[model samples]
Target chain A: MANVRIERLHKEFRGAGGIVHALADLTLDIADGEFISLVGPSGCGKTTALRIIAGLETPTSGRILFDGRDITRLEPRDRNIAMVFQSYALYPHMTVRQNLEYGLRKRGAPRDERARKVAAIAAMLRIEPMLDRRPLQLSGGQRQRVALGRALIRDPEVFLLDEPLSNLDAKLRVHMRAELAALHQKVRTTMVYVTHDQLEAMTLSDRIVVMNHGVMQQVGRPEEIYSRPANRFVAEFIGTPSMNMIEGQVRTEAGRPLFTGPGITVVLPRDAPQALPSSGRATLGIRPEHVSLVAPDAPGAIPARVTVSELAGPERFHFVAVEGGSIIVRTPAATVLHPGETVALGFDPDRLHLFDGTGEDAPALR
Target chain B: MPPRNAARLYPLVLLLLAFVAFPLYWMASTSLKPQTEVFRVPPTFVPETWTLRHYVELFWLTDFGLLFVNSLKVCLVSTGLALVVGSLGAYALARFRVRGKEAYGRLVLLAYMFPGALLVIPLLLLFRQLGLTNSHLGLSLAYLTFAVPFVMWVMRDFFASVPVDLEEAALIDGASRLGALWDVVLPQAVPGLIATGIFAFLFAWNEYLFALILISDESLRTLPPGMMRFVSTTDTNWGLIMAASTLATLPMALAFGLIQRYLVTGLGAGGVKG
Candidate 1:
C-alpha cells in the first residue's frame, strides 16, 4: 500500500450560467494504511475530492502523488485504486463469481490464479452459495458485500469507498460499518472513505476531514474535531443536536472578564482574555452534553425558562431559553422539568467557547 | 356488496377482444374460401367448401417464393446493419461527452420524426447516381435512413437506463470502454437489442412505398408489391390474394410470437427510471 498526497487540488465545472468551483485548493496527506474519511454536508465536494484521487475526475490545478510518484494524470486503472460506489454498482447480468473475477480477468491473470482469488474472496465475504446468483437476486446488503468483494479482489494500493454503506437499512448500515472497519484492519490498505454521515466518520475513520462550502475546515481525530473545532461552523456541524451558540458581548467585569448577552451574563474562565474586541460582540458555544439542570438555588448557575423537554431513551434533552437564544441540556431521564418553568442551567466554565464579535473573525477565547 | 373491479372491466375486455380478433378471423376464413364463394351475396363466415387450390396456384404461377426470399434477405441485412451502427452510436451518445452530443441526439430523433415519403424521391435519384437502383443492397441502404434512426432512438433510451456506475466499475477493473460495453452493458441490454432488431426488421419487411419506387425487377420485388401483380384487369382472384397475404404475414407472426416475452421485458426495463 502507498500513501497519497494531494497538493492544493482544485476542480471547477463550467455549467450554462457560470463556473461552479466544486473543490478549491484542497491539500491532504493520507499516510500508508491510514483510514481517512472526508465528511461534510451535501454538495461540499467531498465526493469530488475522492473521485479526483481515484482518477475518475481531473483537477483544474495542483498535483496528486502516490508513494512519492506523481500520478495526477494517470488513468483510474493505472492509479491502482479500488472504489466502491454508494449504489453497489454490480453487473446485473453477471453471476457473483464473474463479478469478483472481473478485475483479475481484465488484467489477464492466469485462469488458476483468477479462480483461486475468486474462491478466497468469496469465502472471506461468505458469498460461496451466492456465487452463481445474479445481482438482481441479491438483497441490498448482499449486493454491498459483493461490491466490496469485487474491490478487494483487485488488491489495489488504496481502497476508496464513496458512501458504500449509505444504501443499506439502518441496522445493516451499522453492521457494515463495523465490518468495514474490521476489513480495513485485516487488509491494512490506505483507504480514503467519503460520507456526509458524521457518525460514520467518527466511528470508522482514523482521521476525519471536515469540510464546508467546498473548503476543508479541519482534519483531525474525531475527538479533536468535536471538542476543539477550528471554527464556529465545525463546532456546529460535527455534533449531534449541534452545539448551542449564543451571541453575546465580551467585557471586563470587576477583575475578570465575562460574556454578556441580552438577558444573561456568565463569567469566563480566569485564563481567558480580559481585553475584548472593540465591537464588544462575541458568540459562546457549548455542547448539549456540557450543560446541566440544577436546583434554582445552585451556585454559579444561570436562571432560565425551560421551553421543551424531550425524553431520548435514558437521557433527557431540555431546551432552555436564557436570553436572546436557547441552549440544549442533556440531563437524566428522571430529572423532570415542565415547559415555562424557571430552572437553573449550570455548565462548566472550561467547556465554554468564546469567539470574536464577527463570526468570521479569529476565535478570541478557547 | 360492492361491485368488483373485474366485473367493471368485463365489457371493455370483450370490446377489445372483438376489435382485435375479428380481422384476423376474417382474414383466415377468407383465405380458406373457394373462388366462387369468396364474393357471394352474403359473405360466408366460414367456407362451405375448404380448398388448398389458391395456395397451390400462388406457389406455381407467381414469383411468391422469390419475393419471400428477397424480403427476408433485405430485412435481415438492414436490421443487422441498423442494430450494429445504431447501438454503437447510441452507446457513444449515452456515455461520451463528445462535442455537440446533445445536438446529435436531438438530430437523430428529429430524423426519425420526419416522414419517410418526403425522402423517397431524393433517395431514389441518389440510389440511381450511386448505381444502386433495383439492387438489394440499395434497398437495404434506403431502409437504413428509417431503421437506423428508430434503432438509435430506442437504443439511446435503453443505454441511458443502464447505470454508468457499472461501466465505471468495469473500467476500474481494467476494462476499456469498448470491452466494458461488450462484456457488461450489452449483456444487460440483450432484451433492448432484440426489441430494436425486431422493430427494424418489421419496418423493412412491411415497407411498400420504397420497394415500389426503387425496385422494378420482378426478381427483386418484395412480397407486398409482388402480390399486387396478381390482380388482373377483368377479374381479381380474392382467394389467391388472401393466401398470399396470409403467407406474407406468417413470418411476422412467428417472429413476434418468439420474441414477445423479450419485447415486454425490454420495454419495461428500458422505460423505467434508473
Candidate 2:
C-alpha cells in the first residue's frame, strides 16, 4: 500500500474554446489503505485529477509523490497503478481468464502461477463461469466483474477507479458500490474513485473531495461535508433534495443582525459567529430536512404557501413559496400539506448556513 | 409477401444479373471455343464447338505462366509492405499528438488520389537513378505510392474507431505503450487490415500504366500488360487473351476465400480503440 500525495497539480487542454483548465492547482493527500473519492459534476476536473494520479495524464506543474517518492514523470506501467475505466475496457479478443491474466503475463509471471491467481480472483468475483467466454459474451455486470478482476490481479500499491460503476444499471450500481467497498476493505489498498454521484462518494470514500469548475470546494468526511458544507456550492450540491438559498442581505436591526430577503426577514441568532462576512449581500442556505413545517402561528416562523407536495417512500417533500422564492421542505410521511395551503417554515438555527454572494466566499453556520 | 409482385420483379432482377454476369460468361465461353468460332457473327451465347486449345497455348506455347507468377510476386510484396508500414503510420496518426496531424492526414490522402500517369514519369527518373528500372522491386515501390496511402487512411480511421480506453487500460495493467499497441490495439484492427489489404493488392494488380512503363523484359510483364501483347497492330488473338484474363482472376477469388472468415467475425466487444 502507498500513501499518495499530490501537490498543486495543474492540467490545461487547448480546445476550440481556447485553453480549458481541466485541473487548477489541485492538491490532495490519500493515506495508506484509505478510500478517497473525487466527486464533482461533469467538467469539474475530478476525472482529470484521477488520471493524473494514474500517470495517464501529465500535470502542467507540481508533483505527485507516492510513499514519499517523486513519481510525477514515471510511466504508468512503472507507477504500479491499476485502473478500472468507466467502460470496463475489457479486451474483446480475450476471454475473462485471459483479460485477468494479462497483467501477470506482462509482469512475466509463470503460466501456472498466473492460472492460480486468475482462478482465485475469478472465484472471488464470482466470474469463474465466464473464464472461457470472451468479453463480448458477457452481460454488463459480468463485464464489470471481469474488469475488476483484471485490476485485482495486478496487486498494485494504489488502485484507481474512474467511475467504474457509472455504466451499470441503477440496481447493479448500488450493488457494485458495496462490493467495491468490501473489496477495498479486504485488500486494504489506497484507492481513489472518481464519480459525479454525490451518494457514491459519500458512501464509498473515507473522505470526499468536492470540486466544481476545476476548483476544490471542500474535502471532508461524508457526514461532516453534509452537515457543514464549506460554501454555497457544497450546500446546494450535496444532500438528496438540494439545499435552498435565498439571495438577500444582512442588516443591523435594533443593534442585532438580521437576514433580509425579498419579502421575508430572519433575525440572526445571538450566538452567530463574529467572522460572519460583513458584506451587504448574503445568501441564506437551508437544507430541506432542516426546514420543519409548523402552524402558521408559530413564533419566528416565516409565512409560506405550499406549492407542491411529493411523497417518496417513507418521506414527503413540500415545495413552499416564501418571499417570492420556492423552497423545498422535507418532512415525515405522516405530515399532510397541500398546495395553496399557508404554513410557517421553521428554520433550524444550528443547521442554517449563511454565505457571502461570491463563490470564493466561505459559509458560516449560525 | 405477394407472389404476383415477386413474379413481376423477376425479369428486371434477371436482366440486371445477366448484365453483370454476361462479361464473365463471354470470357469463359470464348476461352473454351476454338479459334475459328471466336469472332463468329451473331454472337452465340454458348460455344457450339468447345476446345481447350487457347488454354493449352496460355500454359505451354508462351511464357505467360512466368508473367502470372511475376504479377503475384509484385502484388503480394507491395500489399505486404503497405500493410506493415502503413499500419505503423496509421497507429502514429491515431495515437500520438503530432503537430499538423490533420494537414498530414489530408496530404497523405491527396497523394493517394494522384493517378499513376502523374507519378510514373517521376518514378521512372527516380528508378533510373537508383538502378531500379525494369526491376520487380521498382514496380512494387511504385505501387506503394498509392497502396501505402490507401491502407494508411483506412487503417487510421479503423484505429481511431477503436477506443483509446483499451490502450490506457493496458498501460495501467503493466504494459508499455508499444505493448499495449500490439496486444490490445492491433488485434482489433484485423477486419480493417483485410479490407485495406485487398484494395491495395488490387491497385497493384490492375496498374497498367506503371507496369507498361516500368517493365520491358518479356519475363517481367504483369498480366494486364502481358495480355496487351496479344492485341497488336497485326493480328489480335482474342481467344488466348480471354483465356489469360480468365486465369488471372482466379488468384483474387482464392485470396478472398482465404480471409472472408475474419471479415465476418470481426468488430465489437473489445474496448473502442480511439
Candidate 3:
C-alpha cells in the first residue's frame, strides 16, 4: 500500500480551435488505505485527475509522489496501480480465468502462486463458475464482477475505479455499490474512485472531493459537506431538489437584521451580526426539507400561494410562490394543499443561510 | 399472391445459371473430346470418343509440371511476404498515433489505386538493369506493389474494428504493445489474415502481363503464360488449350471452396460495428 500525493497538477489539450484546459493546479493527498471519491459534473476533470493518478495520462506540469518518491514519469505498469474502466473492458477472446491471470503472468509470477491467487479472488468475488466462460457469454453484472476480479487478482499498491458501475441498470448499480464498499473494506487498499453520481460519492467515500469546472470546491465527510457547504455551488449541488435561493437586500429593522424582497419579508435572528457589505444584495438559502407549512395564526410565518404539489413516497413537495422565485417545501403526503390555495409557510430563522451578492462567498447561518 | 415475384425471378436466375455453368460445362466436355472433333463446326456437346491423350501429352510432351511448380513457388512466397509486412504495417497504422498517420493510410490506398499496366515497362527495365528479369525474385517484387497494398488496406480496416480497450487491458496486465497485439488482437484477426492471404495468392497466381514480360524461359513460365504457349503461328490447338485451361483453374477453385466460409465470416466481422 502506498500514499499518492499530487501537487499543483495541470493538464491542457491543444485542439484545432484553441487550448482546452482539462485540469488546473489541482492539489490533493490520498492517505494509504483510504477510499476517496472525486465527484463532479461531466467535463469537470474527474476522469483526467484519476488518469493522472494512474499514470495513464501525463500532467502538463506537476509532481506526483508515491510513498515519498517522485513518480511523475513512471509507466502505468511501474506505478503498481490497477484500474477498472467504466466499460469493464474485459478481453472478449479470453476466458475469465485467463483474464484474471494475464496480469500475473506478465509480472512473471510463478505458476502455482498465480493459480492460488486466482482461486482466492474468484472465491472472494463468488465468480468461480464463470472462470471458464468468455466475456460475451456473461451478463452485465457478471462482466462487472469479472472486471473487479481481474483488478483484485493483481493485488497492486492502489486500485483506481473510473465509474465502474455506470453501465449497469439502476437496481444492479445499487447492489454493486454495496458490493464495492464491501470489497474495499475487505482489501483495505488505497483506492481512488471517480464518479458523477453524488449518492455514490456519499455512500462509498471516506472523504468526498466535490469539484466544478476543474476546481475543487470542497472536501470533507458526507455529513460535514452536506450540513456546512463551503459555498453556494456546494449548497446547491449536494442536496436533492436543490436548495431554494432568493436574492434580496439586507436591512436593519428596529436594530434586528431583516431580509426584505419584492413579495416577501423575513426577520433574521436577533443575535446575528451585521457583517455583510452594504451592497444591499444577498441570497437566502434554505433546503426544501427545512421549510414547513403551519397554521395562519402561528408566529414567525410567511404567507404564500401553493403552485404545485407532488407526492414522493410518504412526503409531498409543495412548490410555493414566494417573493422572487419558487421555494419547495416537503410536507406530509396527507396534507390537503392544492394549487391556487393560500397557506402560511413557516421556517426557523436559525436554519436560514445568508450569502453576499457573489455566490462564491462563504455562507453565514442566520 | 407471390406468383408474379417468383415469375419475375425465374428468367434472372436462368440467365445467371447459364452464364456461370456454360463455360465450365464446355471446358469439361472439350477436355474429353478427341483432337479431330474439337472444331467439328456443329460443336458437339458430347464427344463420340473420350481420351486421356491431352493429359498425358501435357505432363510428358510439355513443361506443364515445371510451370505448375513455378507458379506455386512464386504465389506462395509473394503471399507470405505480403501478409507478414502488411499485418505489421496495418497494426501500426491501426493503433499508433505516429506522425503523418493519415498520410500513411492515404498513401497505402494510392499505391493500390496506381495502374499496374503503366509500371510494367519501367519495372522491366529496372529488373533488367538489376539482373532480376526472368527470376522468381523479380516477379515477387513486382507482384508486391499490388499485393502489399491490398493486404495492408484490408487488414488495417480489419484491425480498426477491434476495440482498443481489449489491447489496453492486455497492456495493464503486463504485456508490451506488440505482445498484446500478438496475443489478443491477432487472435481476433485470424479470419482477416486468411481472407487477405487468399486475395494476395489469387492476384499473384492469375497475373499474365508481368509473367509474359519477365520470364523468357518456357520452363520458368507460370500457368497463365504457359497455357498461352500452346498457341502458335500455324494453328491454335483448341483441345490442348482447353485441357490446360481446365488444369490451371483447378487450384483456384479448390482454394476458394476451402476458404469461402472463413472469408465471409471474417469480412462480416470486420464490417459490423462492435
Could you arrange the candidates by lDDT from highest to lowest?
A: 1, 2, 3
Q: Residue B121 error for model 1, in Å?
A: 2.0
lDDT of 2 at B45: 78
Across all models, the iRMS values in order are 0.9, 0.6, 1.4
Candidates, ranked, DockQ: 2, 1, 3
| Model 2 per-residue lDDT tens digits across residues B1-274 | 6999999999999999999978988998999998888888987778999899999998888678888899999999999999999999999998898889999999999999988788989989989999888899889988999999988888887888888899999998889988998999888888888878887998899889999998888878888998888888989999999999888877886877887776454333212433
Q: Clash pairs of candidate 1?
A: none
What is candidate 3's CA lDDT for residue B118? 88
- For candidate 3, list the clashing residue pairs, or say none: none
| Per-residue lDDT of model 2, residues A1-366, tens digit only | 899999999999987699999889888889999999999889999999989989999988989999999999999989998999999999999988889999999999999999899989999999998899999999999999899899989789999999999899999999998999999989999999899999999999899999998988899999999988998888888888998888888877787778888887888787765555666778888899989977677777889999899999899999999875899999889998988999988888777788876454455544
Q: Whole-model lDDT, candidate 1?
A: 0.88
For A1-366, candidate 1 gives per-residue lDDT tens digits of 999999999999887889999999999999999999999999999999998998888999999999999999988878888989999889887899999998998899999999999899988988899999999999998899999999999899989999998889999999999999999999999999999999999999999998877889889999998888877777888888898888878888788887887776788889886567778888888899998877778766788998999999998998988867788998889988899999888777888877776474345355
For model 1, residues B5-47, the per-residue Cα lDDT tens digits are: 8899889999999999788777778888888888898888978
Question: Per-prediction fnat values?
Answer: 0.79, 0.92, 0.58
The best candidate in terms of DockQ: 2
Candidate order (TM-score): 2, 1, 3
Question: Which DockQ value does candidate 3 get?
Answer: 0.57
Question: How good is the docking of model 3, by CAPRI class?
Answer: medium
lDDT of each: 0.88, 0.88, 0.86
lDDT of 3: 0.86
lDDT of 3 by residue, A10-72 (tens): 999876789999889899999999999999889889999988887777899999998989989
